[model samples]
Target chain A: MPSWPTLRLRRQSAPAAPDKPLATVETQHGQRRLAAVCPRAAAMGLRVDMALAEARAICPELTVVEADPEADRAALAALAAWCERYTPLAAPDPPDGLFLDIAGCAHLFGTEAALAEDLSLRLQRNGLAHRIAVAGTAGAAWALARSATAGAPCTVLPAGAERQALAMLPVALLRLDARMVAGLRRVGLKRIGELARQPRAELSARFGPLPVLRLDQAYGAAEAAIAWPRPPAPWAERLAFAEPIGTPEDLSRALAELARRLCARLEAGQRGGHRFAASFLRVDGQRPAIAIATALPLHDAERIAKLLGEKLDTVAPGFGIDAMVLEAEETAPLRPPQAALADLGKPQDTELAAAIDQLANRLGSARLWRAAPHASHVPERTVRRLPPLAARPAWESDPAVERPIRLLRRPEPIEATALVPDDPPILFRWRGALHRVRAATGPERIAAEWWRRTPQEQRPETDLVRDYYRVEDNNGARFWIFRAGLEGMPRWFLHGLFG
Target chain B: MPAPASLAVLRARLHALQPQAGHGVLPFGDPRVDACLPEGGLALGALHEVGAAGIEAETGAVAAGFIACLLARLPGIKPLFWIAPACDLHAPGLLAYGLDPGRLVLVQTRDDAETLAAMEAVLREGAATAVVAEAGRLGRIASRRLQLACLKRGTTGFVLRRWPHGRTAAVQEATAAVTRWQVAPAPSTAAHREPGPPRWRVELAHARGGIEGAWIMQAGGSSDAAHPLRVVAELADAAPAPAVRPGRAG
Candidate 1:
């Protein structure tokens, strides 16, 4: 196995267990003893340095863990996922430090201390080695964590007491290299307070400028930041279950609540999010979330629920989820509904959306898309998918030019026998049946979009330039056909038929 | 002298949505056929047709064929619907009769039973001016139910018959229709001057509103290229017994 770069857990192993084979290291009792004799002692009295065999002589039973730096990192990642339920800002405790900004939520649980206690308790239950500290400044919190009395929370040093609060901590807590710490210790620097008192230039010259700068952050003398996990996105609404949800119905009910809340929030802000993300936070500390992204922004709760329902199959609530949260991402200007009472008397947007939503559920979402014209002549690029959250648009407008009422996404190729290079072919075969062209229109030319294309565009995958024609066969049947690439020799494909 | 108020009121209510009252109001396949329909036109909802005709036996496409000819002359942009449960309605054939595809909606369904029901539903609530469903003979109750539906919606209901195995549950047994025509093969077209596909020869087996029997007329076509896919319908007074028999061998 490849050994990865890791934080050294300890200098040596602890004493061995009396009952089990694996050995352990000694703690502050300072004498070697079997780990089985008192495992609790290993947690407390064991020193960071003590060879395994030497400690085994004092206590025979000890359990040793071959250090797993990788697992530790993964566990921290899982912790991050768990934290995502609370806020979008959950991240790894970088190099063994977790910084959380629970600013507006302090009063939600009564006080910052209560929030910390709740957070610490949850972490403990999930088997995490965590200690939380909150202060007016990031610097104060960082300094207080390693400096405060053991087993106690952060010491909230008064505004001027930053230097005093940091004074007693060992220089090891200053986050410097061992060589620098040893060098500082050898030169009569006893405590962090002593280092703080040294002349600025002298310390910079003697121990280097980095340590002094870090010290400033520790003492709240300089501004510090707790880098958030991911950027706090647009809108998020959370639902706390009075009774935890285990059934899909329960989850759906929770979704309705979140949709209403989120929609209202969007309405109040006069905005709407194009994407709706619903997260089900599992009791096992694993969050499985599913999101539906619309091509448009809408706040209709029923529509939102339907879109989310389209994706509900992806969420497997293993055992059960204790809470559910919904977040809206990528917001846009909210549209005031213009549908009149005349429309309400008939089938409305809600009904249409519901019907389309049902069909969309049966057919895959990708299969359900409406297209509108774009500013491109490249036929494929000339149309784009209308956003799902948007209302249906009118089909006809002023005719700047004649356009086909029917258009096919992909032109179906015809099996050709009679070859005509210059003009529309007199006969074409489709669906194994022959159609003889009787009346025909022009071989209209459309050039390639050269300016908007790249090197890859030079070689079209199908490599055909198209000149379209409206042809009525001998049978009075109308067909939309095309001859490829206008400027030169073109191929043919039967595109569509007028219905 | 003005008609009495009570008498005028009686006449209006009696014929409200009555197809007989609307005769001569609109054009159908000759006024004779139009007078027979309750709506005096194709029932506007959804119409279904099932073809049991072979190229040698031209009568199979008769019901659908008749409707197509009638609808071809329909004016305005009102859309028409034609549904078939048997997958036998040909699109090109419809276009041959001059029914505009833009204004005509075609739907293929599973079987006569489903198609009949679907067509009935569409007729009840849709914009189709005609509802035609094909079934093996429709039972009296079924015909009455369909008739009531058409009457309420001001639609024309045509229960196009298919060859049933037994004493059918057909509209013939269900109600005395305004007109019931027996359609069969006619002689080859003198214009085409070749052995060609069978053409229909129609005979009026029953008619309450028009001549009971008449000369069978040729079904017409407009030749762009002269599709040559034609069916001839000439009216006759009392069709041959076997011709009117439900599903009897020709």
Candidate 2:
């Protein structure tokens, strides 16, 4: 089995300038105090929780700044995202640190020692003061990273060597509170080795279960799972600019290149993405992203670029964009088109589908719709609206009934006179004109759904029975008119039109 | 001098050498109506306008039914998209005219411009086989754009002119349609009319390379009952007497 090499960053909150004695202070119990101290401040005989006035008295030139934990957390998350270049599994260990599970990636940099050295060199180039420790378990790594001497800022412990490696580290490095560390020191257990040698049940009964759990975790006896801030997409590509690009054309060019690269990766995996999102990282700390969806899964870079181009105006590249990343938000296994000549006729269909996807991408998807049939006798409830690409409704069960071509939005009232109560209208005045009914069809009775109506709704006005008539006027015009209400005085309303 | 028989045969040969007459035409299944068209039938992959012969609700209803019957008779399985200003299309009514409720996609737009835009998009994408759009006043450029889109993807387009109220004349702005037809409701053929097959006075006002003509036709049950649009009669230039009335024997 392969070993799990866990790496942790210590003193992650330290400022960029290590030469100055910089200390971050926060209000503790309404009193201004030092929350954390840099290495220079610590070397200058100042410690954490020291009062600002006392620290200023100790070092006349001490620089004290208010603690901004939010900024520190943001820095840690950005560092974690940067660490993804080395290993796919990188998590932000908050309040100022990062965790990298670099198991199999060590070989890419020659050796584990070399990988740690490379990471140290890169962090140093970025002017970040950090100590990195690699071990078989995260707890051991965390302990060693925090307790390492200033001369050696990087350490790598071989697998199963966590106990020996951590033996010299102090109990405070075990991530315990100040009170717990003071209690452990008072009990004559100053080093991690002394704590580990104590009787387990006694230690649990005295100092509670946390110290014991920490020791077990350090020695690889317990499990530790790191929660990553943002899970890395399987297929993603990034393009970084030395100088930020401010022009829309340049941004488009950069996005096209990134999309092409991502499409290449997707093609290698024989997969297609149904949805893609492009994020533009601006220099002024704004990250704007645009996402587009396709009806058919696609891996072609040009098609993706086209869709993205349509939405380029929506992406605001304020100040300037420094880096752009394209990620496939949703993907599926692609079934390549068959090479047989018999299937050649389907290219037109494919073209049509692509065109539709483009239009849907440009206009919102909700704007494109299909008609769906409903199983209802009500004239208005017989059809439904669906997306354009939905499957066709079943045709075998469609009843052969005579229906009008165009239906009015609502039944418009008209004056009509019939020779008999049951007979069709002989003359009607609709839209202020009298129409002499030259010929007419019978009254097709359509009853309303009584089961849906309540007892209170069974009023004379809510009478829902309709007798539809297909009538033609003297000037050769047809109408689908209906009569509702009572038989004694039926109210006539025009409902549909037949060309 | 050429002999009469030889001259006739020579003319036929010349006509055959020209571009195939019925290459892009969709037959109406009625020879009498097809005979009036330049291509022997309705031209496919082109725009056609349908409107009421008179400014009345009943005439508009007849025109709508005529388009519905044509839509039901369209070949293949491509879905139909109908764009209108409102949700005014009656699905049940269309079903009675032979258009399946399932095959119809209704897109309700806010205005005439949006309706035209949606129709153009549907035609250009070729996502739908046929598109039927209702508009108030379609300009020449807008109709041309729709026509061009249809020609690009071989889509059939139907533009229904829903005349605005209080206007006695139809909205007749010049358009880019291959055929312009006006259909009015005619009396049923059966005496003591028991709701026999529907009849209409169909007038072909515009056809490329063809003279305008008018005819009276009837829709009856054909082999394909799902789309039973047949032209039953061909009226002369002179008006014919009212053949039958509703409650009286002819």
Candidate 3:
């Protein structure tokens, strides 16, 4: 196995509480005990698993805060997100640290040494005290970053040199629980080198399989891959300038150039994209991104540039933008546009796409929607609201039946006068208005959705039938009202109005 | 004297502004109705105002139905956009007027401003063949904006005035609309015995570069009928003759 460039950040929780000798205490067995100690508390000889009383006695001025494992986890996750600017593969090293795979990214900062130096300088400016170590293996890097002295804060081990790095670190650095460390200590093993000297079979038999597995991982003899915060995006292009750009004209020019380059690559690959996002990395460490989506697949650089230009006002060029990256996150296979005849007029399809893209960019994609027909028998559920570009079933309308030009969001109850128990209404009073019926017709019954009811040994409680009527008032007003429920004691509601 | 010379120059400029050819008119296919309109038909790239003859729901429904039928009769598969604040329209009633549910796109806006904006956008984009909007309050500036947008693309627009509180005063206000119409449900024909078709008395109150007249029209017929509807007759208001009674002077 060869070496992998891994960066580890250790003691990730202490920077949150600067200027305080903090000791995190937890309630174990109904008694307070120290879970972890910060650097200042550690300088006072406070230790993990020490009783709170003993720690208080040792350092009377110590600040004791209850341990929050969740907060520590969240801080590590945020750090991992920040580290993504350096490498695509960045993951939280659980309760306290982060692991970054920067194998090919070191050259971006000129060299590995420069990368480590830059990281150190940035963390210092951010008020976070970190001990970072770059090693050939994540396990070896983790062990070295935690146990190595302050003078050797940034340790870079050569390829296949994990054995030597693990040999110098303590056995406790192997990520073992307290019982495993105590078992190894009882067996007279104090360092990783001592454990490596024993036969592998004998070591496993004495301390279970964990010690051998941990040693193999740290020695670069086992498979270990860090789980990144998210899988890498399919396509991304980034440009970093020597000097930050502040003017809108320059920004627009740069954006057009990037669009051209990205579209060229997409053309070469025979692909088109519906979603394009450009992230502006400001010098102040604030990332502002603008995303534009088209209703149809498009790869024209000029069109993309125009759409992005419309959103340039939203990107605050605060301090100045030092770098910009463009990504075609959602893409599809390109279909060649049909050749146009001179007398055929402009291609209406492409014109519609351009107009839709412009409107969606301004009004938001949610505001531009189309009603799609569904197979449901329920009137309201028969049509669904969907994005404009979403594929919908062919509209099959029953013209023989009458439908309202507008349907109320919900049916409103109305008082009505009827001749019989199941007959149509003669007159109705709605919204505090009484109307005399001039003519009336109907009793169009729509039964309940019986398929929705399961085979329960019960009555038809889930099924309610409706008897609709079309009536004209003496004032020449028409309405579509319905009687809910069946037979006796039914309620009348105004469902919709007729033209 | 200066205004007349400037008006002549403005007329020349306006003549130059009109698009070439007659590709924008939509004929009603009836001589009585089409002859009363400029270009011998309804013009695209313009805003038209439609309102009920009375404040009753039946009259408003007839007005809306007439526009719906007109939009459906256009020679294209393009969709129709109808923007309104409070659409008390029955979907089935629209079908009775010959509009296909598949070709309909409804936009229920919250206020008159949104309605106007949506109408303008739809017209400017030419995404829909026609945009019909129901508005309670439409200022002059908003109507001008809609007309300009309609001119950008040869899209037709219909502004149906459905004033709240059943007020008809807004119908008489000065508007930028190229045409104004009033629709009311007329008495049905008696000889058919069965419910023949829905009839309406359509009055062309205002028209640009054309004359105004009133017509009696039918909108629908039975399943076996050849045509959906037709213009049955044209109406003319008759002047009353002076009376010479025994006790009164003529």
Measured by TM-score, the strongest candidate is: 3
Q: Please, what are the lDDT tens digits per residue for candidate 3 over residues A1-499?
A: 0000001112443333455567778999999998877666777898888999999999887776677777667666766766766776789887677888889999998877678788878877765667777887888888888885536547777788888768867798988988999989998999999999999999888889999998988987886777887666666677778899978898899999899988998889889988999988777667789999988888899989888988898999998988888888899998876666862653266655665577577666665555666666455555666665444225554655665555665777899887887776667788768976666557677776778765656644323677777666654455667888865687888776555
TM-score of 2: 0.68
lDDT of 2 by residue, B1-250 (tens): 6699899999999986674433277777665566566667677778898876455332356666778778777765667788876566666666556667677666666677878877887787686778898876778899889877887777889998775566445447778887888777776665565556677878887766554667776665454643366666666772223233222111
Name the weakest run of 10 consecutive residues (lDDT summed) in model 1 chain A. A1-10
For model 1, residues A1-499, the per-residue Cα lDDT tens digits are 0011111222122234333434323344665433221223344444334655665554445455544446545655665767654555666654456566666766767777777777777765543444566776565566566553645543434456767666877776676778998999999886888888889898999877877877887776775655665567668888766556788787887898889988988888988787677888897778888877554467778778867876787888887788787888688996777878666554334433443344344333544344444676655565455544344333333222334323444677885433457666778887556887665666666666667565765765334457777665554445567776655445578765432
Order the candidates by lDDT, highest first — what do you get? 2, 3, 1
Model 3 earns a TM-score of: 0.77
lDDT of 3: 0.72
Candidate achieving the largest DockQ:
2
Q: What is the per-residue lDDT of model 3 for residues B1-250, given as tens digits with 9 covering 90 to 100?
A: 7999999999999987885344477787787677677767788768898877554432257678778777766665456677776655544456676666556666666766777877886787687678888886777888888877777777789998876544545346777888888777665553322223456778888786666778877776664443355788878751112132122211
Better of 1 and 3 by DockQ: 3
Question: TM-score of chain A for candidate 1?
Answer: 0.64
Task: Name the lDDT value of residue A209 in candidate 1.
Answer: 83
Ranking by TM-score: 3, 2, 1
The C-alpha lDDT values of all candidates are: 0.55, 0.74, 0.72
lDDT score of residue A428 within candidate 3:
77
Model 2 residue A426 lDDT score: 90
